[model samples]
Target chain A: MMLNLFHLTVLSFISSLKEETLPVAEFVNKSVKWITEKFSWFFDPIKNDFGDKLEDFADMLAEIPPSIVIVLVVLIAFFITGKKFGLATFSLVGLLFIYNQQLWEELMLTFTLVLVASLISVIVGIPVGILMSKSNLAENIIKPILDFMQTMPAFVYLIPAVAFFGIGMVPGVFASFIFATPPVVRFTNLGIRQVSKELVEASDAFGTTGSQKLFKVELPMAKTTIMAGVNQTVMLSLSMVVIASMIGAPGLGREVLSALQRANAGTGFVAGLGIVILAIIIDRITQNLNKESA
Target chain B: MPVIKVNNLSKIFGKKTKEAQKLLDEGLKKEEILEKTGCTVGVNRASFEVEEGEVFVIMGLSGSGKSTLVRLLNRLIEPTEGDVEIDNENLAKMNKDDLRKVRREKMSMVFQKFALFPFKTVLENTEFGLEVQGINKEERSKKAKEALELVGLGSFIEQYPSQLSGGMQQRVGLARALANDPEVLLMDEAFSALDPLIRKDMQDELLDLQEKMQKTIIFITHDLDEALRIGDRIALMKDGSIVQIGSPEEILINPANDYVEKFVEDVDRSKVLTAENIMKRPETVDIDKHGPRVALERIREQGLSSIYVVDRSRNLKGYVTADDVSDAKKQEKKDLKEILRTDMPTVEKDTSIQEIFDIIHDASVPVAVVEDGKLRGIIVRGAVIAALANGNEVNGDDA
Candidate 1:
């Protein structure tokens, strides 16, 4: 009887202040709307011009002969992976299969997106990671921001990203940039921090300046770890491709999205297969690079 | 002036150092301070000075702050209190730029872990100090190669640090430090990671190098034997406080307290007992004036199997057994030199009993303690054994 009374009291308490009374959803909607309205001036040039440039870059990559691209990538695979013909053959066959499926142009565009996104992550994430490793204040502040970037459902970033950059590959990149950057930053911080303390002392004992120590001792020692981070960034960016297509980004992801819309299992399966092949090839190449450097 | 002077250097690892410092100044013990403020007293107001060209050793057990104390000299671990002065300039108070200048131009350190850059080849790792100093590539490479050659790693320069053994890796670390050609070399337990035999070899190599270059070296080691072997003076630390500081002989013969007495008690006396301390006055027949008959008579009277034969100037010639001298006298061989065994081993006065143990162990005759080509004293097998069994009692036998 007492438990039932307590339950009824709690239920009445929640019912007393319910629904839009919280104003959380309405508040978020207004904030996003306000940001979009105010930032249209800033977002316009980036959306129009940067969007055109990214598409042109993707188109330029697509224009390359599939066979030539295949041979070049296979050659890179062969050389970097200790000349393993097995890996070289796998890349050769994987690219040929994607080409055979008529997803060559889409694959090229996806490649461009992942490539640029990963490049941006490395360029921005490494210095931030280095900063985090060097300073506890930076680590304390940036760490939570990174956690927010990583753990919040990747879909949530799309709302802000679109508000700032608008629809297409530009926002796709912005979304991927948010989602994929944490691993690189986190890994970079961890890598640099993991450098042997004695080595650090040896460097300092010789009186190395900040940049000298970073470039000469810390970075070189942390290379494998940082590279591992970069690899993770690239993989995460690849994972973001299909989700990015919801924003009208052009890639194999768009083909998969269209296939889903038409309810054509065959077409969707083929496009998904193309993505899987691409993911495998990229993953192997990055992993091989890691082993070779180490 | 001393090359490196450290004054009341203290390092307290804690957030509440102000309170810990207050407690420290109030003369609270390290444990008391830790209980009060939760701070680890890494080095507690340790003070010492290292003279130019002297091997000033800082030695203690692990966590005794020997490592912390050494790091303070180069300002690797900033001091919580007091100051370290290199030459006349205060290292603890200097700005970052000036402190860096002192580090780059005045001092270099070799680590216990042989912290060479793994990605770099031996040549690259060795030149790292000079490289960071902004020396030109050509100049730095040349110096690095020479340093590697000095450490006997010239052939291994093209290889990576991972390719070398522990001993050779430390040689690269030594080379890296030497490449900068700094005036002061700080070695923090540099050979503590090596095999015992290799550690001994490295110690000897360092001694040889120090003698030639005379760089003021601050060597840190937990091994008392190592400190005794290489140190011109030793500072013994306990609970981050320097309990005593003195020459090795002084430290060994007159340890400041029971802590030191117990520490030195475990050191192998053979390594510390030199031939000079154990040698007795030799009973010899002068080959310049005495015949083999006189040598035999002296050997018989002394109730000894063998006797050393020295010249009128007391220059060591050789030794003669009583059987040989008697045989020579009976054969009408007049000269003691004719019966003398010149193959008997001779050791220098400063040669440790450890070095003479093997020769004395199987010897048919007593070993001559020769110095400057003159017969200084004699060392028999029993004397070496006696020195090993009893620490400093052999010094009394010099009479």
Candidate 2:
């Protein structure tokens, strides 16, 4: 009897709101299609320009022989981090391990994707974050928008990204950018806001202009925090590669996706290990950059 | 002439400043004005003038608007109402570019926290003011080096501010201000963060610098002892308004109201009151005119056992005791010089009362207040005791 009553309530609720009558999904689809049709000229140029540059960069990374790439990364690790031999050796061994798996080209492509996505996120995110820090109006408006971008499921954004940029590396880059951008923006704003009040007052007392204070005092003091933001962006972008490969992006992510389809556990495990190695190398390098600046 | 003149200056910090200003003009108290307009009155109608070469101090407890008042002098914190004139030019009327120029050239500030840029070396910090003025690199560095030498920080120029002690960092802060060779220096509690010994040393260093440079200084501090020690003149503030403005002696002797009296109640009077403050005109015998008989008569008339003998120019030759005058009279001496006691206690007019205690303790007569051999006044033992016991009473009626 109790089960019958529950079923009756569910039936009544279901009858009141039909999916076709709601029309929310359809409205969103139609608006997206109309906007694309009307504004393709505006978006197409930007998309083409970014797509060409990104592809060229990826090709450049691929053109380098695996041995030369490993040595170059090892040298960079040593020089940029104040001659830390441990870090340099670790980077060399890590790259060699990835190379041994015969996944070198796939790792390079994944590296390029993460690099481009992180770069775009930083370039767009920093100034917006600065703007947010400087004005209360910008902070109030951007804060909720950043919250939505960060909290909404990463998969949900891929749909709109595909509608706008189509299914290719560009859409994958676009999707990864959307997923990775919030941290850099949030940390930039937080970093600038955390600058000591006394330091700001001192700069003003010395007659510094608004721009001079921002560059000379605020940015230098906020270097570590902003670098932390960049590190987070890199990691987030790396995490999104597999999810992004569902839309035709190529990389270790594509290998993992193929392995999943074939139900091949060994292939999937090796690709996953490669991704982990890449993440650790990049993370250590960025953290060392942060420490050196500090 | 005044180097800086602040006229009817007021600063209300909050969004409702306009309404707060109206309430202020309507004669509302700070609390009442805040309640009516939801604004904090940082400074309220403060008016004062800082003379050239004078150490003008603005002193108050925390949240009394003394810090705000100094910032307003250089327009670091804009005033809601009023005008500050540096030389003859009105600061309130100047545009942003002109204000910056003034800050760069005419005024420099030393912060309470020794606001040296943490990333900058001592030399770089010292060069900040000159760099802001667009001076050439070579010239600015030379000037910065000179300024650092002036503050005794030349050896530490290569070190970062974090590497220096609090006193050393504050010296770098001072050097930074001096590097501009500004006409006015605004120091906001420049030594309050230092240890007591270091604070005293810094005060003496500032005095030494003042003696050589003679630059006009406007210093802010919450400590009364610091103010008394350094200020040529002090303005005391309470609840965002200046309650009194006077020399340290004037403030101590005649506090304006109950608030000021309470503020100064714990002060050690002997350190503040000088011989000039407690001295009086002395009974004297002239060396050029008065003979032994006249000297003895004058001493007896004044009911004293001795009298100071001065030459025709009032040059304090010495003091003559009554017994010595009588002996001179019995011997029919023509020269009063022989009767003169040149070893009698003598002190400068500016000597503090504390120094006078030892001088008067063993003296047979009043101590002569002398300056460059001229007799200024005389300090008696009784006067010092009376002044100490009734310290606040001296200037009680003046307020």
Candidate 3:
């Protein structure tokens, strides 16, 4: 009976992979048609009102010469991460000016959303990690769930998120969170588990209570690994931003996706550059913060 | 009076009675507990005591329950059946809170591995014990600084544990224990992990510390030399039970059992013996410094080849002999170095008897004398033989 079940499971898994490939091809096929329909909807009265409001805001931002603010932020980041990363950052931002794309506001919006999602992931992931460490049953049950969440594609995560929240910024946030949370949890667990047994015993010998050990010994030693986890989470969130834009998540992701649909390579390329610039800044800044803390 | 005592601390493992009995029936030693139960028994029905300020050493081979027995004292591991009384308090029945209070206030342990917190700075690791006692950060930091000074690592306070060498890290561990200033210090092979030279340095450091702050110490070691060097009373354990517990002198001259005798038989007993054991009594006449005939008569009267010379002030001058006086007469002017065997080894009055044989083997001399700078009296191999023959009964004349 076990052998028959194993054979059946293998056949089903192979079939699922073949079945999932069909939707990917179909998605590319209908791209042009979808873009035209999307363009017409943008001109509709209600949609036009929203687009005009956003356009006006972008125009106001354009008048301020964002290069000044970008420079200031870049300098502050440089102070945190050091000069090598700072100069690399300035060059990436300079590319945005060279491309002369009108999607700078969209880039900022995407950056904000990813930052928010990753911060929340870290805050929530740590407690779950501590709980898993404390209880064997919890660890056992969570292990398979965590493994599944990590192994599944971030795109697959979008379906359930969209089904629950529907298409908007909220669903985009939900998707980004699901995409980014696994590393935070995995690294936190590893960090806590890696603390020295001798240190643990020393603290115990000194009559350190449970909370004291967790705070004084366990948390401090786990800090480096947890920060590394945060690094991974940020990178993962950046990867999900463009995918999130399909659900009306306003950002460089949406700008790039729309440009791609119309085969506007110049526009798409510029938006893609903006995304890369944002990813690099966020990655460098958080990584430096972690290094300092460690 | 016994400040701490233990009784019948047997720890059996596995649920099967037949297996335990079968192993016992096969004449397995208590150390064979691991092979039978598949679980290690750290302490086996062991018992001993420490006086108010005694430096008691529990010496044994690895896995002989020395470390476990020390842990059992502080309730680090709960004893299976024994009652451990610490200063009239029943530790076996204390609740967790009370036990914590006891550890925080009365006792502290130094680990063999020097369990300093790797992430914390040396200052922070040293202050950890005080922090656990709920002292505020500023106050504990002050105390930790003081402790670092005590162990002579004051300048390395801000450095992390990884920055320090093994000896420095263990000094921090010792400072951590000392920071709390508990009444009882339990050292679980704390210096065993350092390099041999560093181990010697740490031992000297501990001896200096002990002189200033005489806390009751329960030190554990597998090294016999370390036991003899530091222990006020040494307990030699085999299988699980203590074969003997006494001063290093008593154990060397008269071991309580054949096992202890076999353990110390190959050891150099001269290094462990004190000068008092080898010194001649006041009734024994000293050989005259200038009379050749009289010195020879005194040597023959004492049935010894040599006799010690001393001034009327009772200060040792040097050892003299009938041959020394005759040689002095043959030569008009005598060289003091040739007349006297100033090369003879001497030891402190309280040195262990084992050191005597050790010095004699190395020196290949007939006798070594007990002295205070100059020779007081001679202790020939005959004295040691007489003491060994009489065993512990050699209480008066021999040693």
Candidate 4:
């Protein structure tokens, strides 16, 4: 009862603002409508005609048996992270296959999206992290933006992304990018900042220039934390794939959403299985990369 | 000409605020802010000159600003007021490019932590400074290898800093600094972090390196023993100002005040005092090395407290006191090392007098300063007592 009262109070407050602040509220409302209309034409094609293209992108990837790729990836994990990790890699894949709905094509699209997003995340995230760590002003300005980007609801991110680029793999890629980037930036900053003060001073004492200090001391010390952030980014990006399908994004998210709409439990279960497999594959690869670096 | 000169240098931190920044920018004195806000004076109106190829030490306790003073010389921290002239160039006003160039070409430093890069192997850490100067990677590798060899880390080039002991890590740190071949090396308590035995070895290694490299070093440490052993001249600092600057001998013999005297009071003089403190003129030494009974007869007849021993080259060998001869009287044949207590109160010729007292206290024997393992003269208890009292050479014979 108290919670309902509190919700009522908040809703009343918002409703009162519309009356008391008409012009300002109207301005916000019209601006949003105008933006939606201006961009509506561009999005019409993705809504109307892009389904076959996305389906084919999904299909092309789906033809490869996940078990083969899983085995290959497990071997690679062993090569990179050693035998102890390879066993975990194989076991995790087996669990995903048994538990998931097992639609291979949809899973492949999710896997490709995660791989591309994680790559972009690292490339962009590290430099920003280095810059923020080096400059106090940059850190102060960038921190709040990163906080907002990470904490806001995932669906809310889709709204702006759709408004800008419309609903398709492009918008899906972009939404996942926004959702996944915060951990990388935050961790990169943390890793660089946490480097030992004595070590940094020692480098300075040895007459190392600013650039050498960064490359030789700061970056290397920051590697463990930065890799952790990369792992989080991969996980976060994969999480967004299923959510992106709500707005006509192809692959496992679409299959799951469509199956749910029709109440077809078998279709939904199989698609969910594929998504799980894709998630496991990505998680293993990135986790192994981190261990190898370590 | 002096290789380095510092004049009227001071560093004032946090002098400006929102209300008073304009006044400071317009050349207000720091004292004027005493009524409003506060400021920390890191380096007071300090002045000193270091001659070429001298190991000039700045000794101070933590927060005394000796470290800050050295940093000021390199413009690592810019001075609020004054000039640092290194090889005749004013460092305070150097542009960034020039300052960077100067640091690259003329000054290297070793930190207490032995700041080896944990990410890179020892060889790579050594090469990093040279790499900053835009040297090619291959050249850097070769130079770094040579530097590692210099510091005796040649076999461990592939090892990361984590794999090495503290002493070995410091060696890599030293190698990195040496790789630059800077004319002036600044060490801020560089060996203070090592264990006692390692500290001693590092000190000896530093002295050997100084002998070979001929690099002028400005070493900072709170350990007076280290200062006495390694410094050609030492500047003792208290607070932000120098208390005394002199050779170790002058400091031990004539400490400027109660502060310097108290610092010297506990130093083991045996390690610090040299043969020069104890040796007499060679012609004045009337005893032979192994004549034995005759020298004992002379001691009884003359009522002497101690007798000096010298080699054919007129260098100090050791000294035998009246007590040692009497003790040796019962034995038929006595070698000098056995008769002399073997552990004689001895010092290097360059040891300070304060250190002499330290050695005297430890060995409980009369002091002798040695040159090439032979005696110069004997500074018996009376000689040191008289020197302490009269502040110079004593005129009285041993009682």
Write one digit per residue (lDDT tens) for candidate 4, span B46-106.
8999988999999988878898998888777778888888899988888877777778778
Which runs of model 4 end up more than 4 angstroms from their true locations?
A1-19, A22-60, A63-68, A85-102, A205-210, A262-270, B15-36, B275-378, B384-399
Those runs of model 3 whose alpha carbons end farther than 4 Å from true positions after fitting are A1-65, A83-99, A263-266, B10-37, B237-243, B255-270, B276-348, B351-378, B381-399
Q: Which consecutive 10 residues in model 2 chain A have the weakest lDDT in total?
A: A15-24
Clashes of each: 0, 0, 19, 31
**Candidate 1 pairs with clashing backbones:** none
Docking class of 2: medium
- In angstroms, give how far residue A294 of model 3 lies from its true place: 2.1
* DockQ of every candidate: 0.67, 0.61, 0.49, 0.33
Candidate numbers, best lDDT first, in rank order: 1, 2, 4, 3
Cα displacement (Å) at residue A205, model 3: 1.3
Candidate number of the best lDDT: 1
Candidate 3 structure quality by residue, lDDT tens digits, A1-294: 999999999999998887756676577446644653565553343244543544455446555566765767667676776655755567456545643666666765676667767877888888888878777898898888888877787777676455444465656767777778888887888888888877777777888888998999998989999899889998988888889988777788898899989999988888888888777677777888898887
Better candidate by DockQ, 2 or 4:
2
Interface RMSD of each: 0.7, 1.2, 1.1, 2.3
RMSD in angstroms between candidate 2 and the native structure over all alpha carbons: 4.1
Q: Whose DockQ is greatest here?
A: 1
| TM-score list, all predictions | 0.85, 0.93, 0.75, 0.78
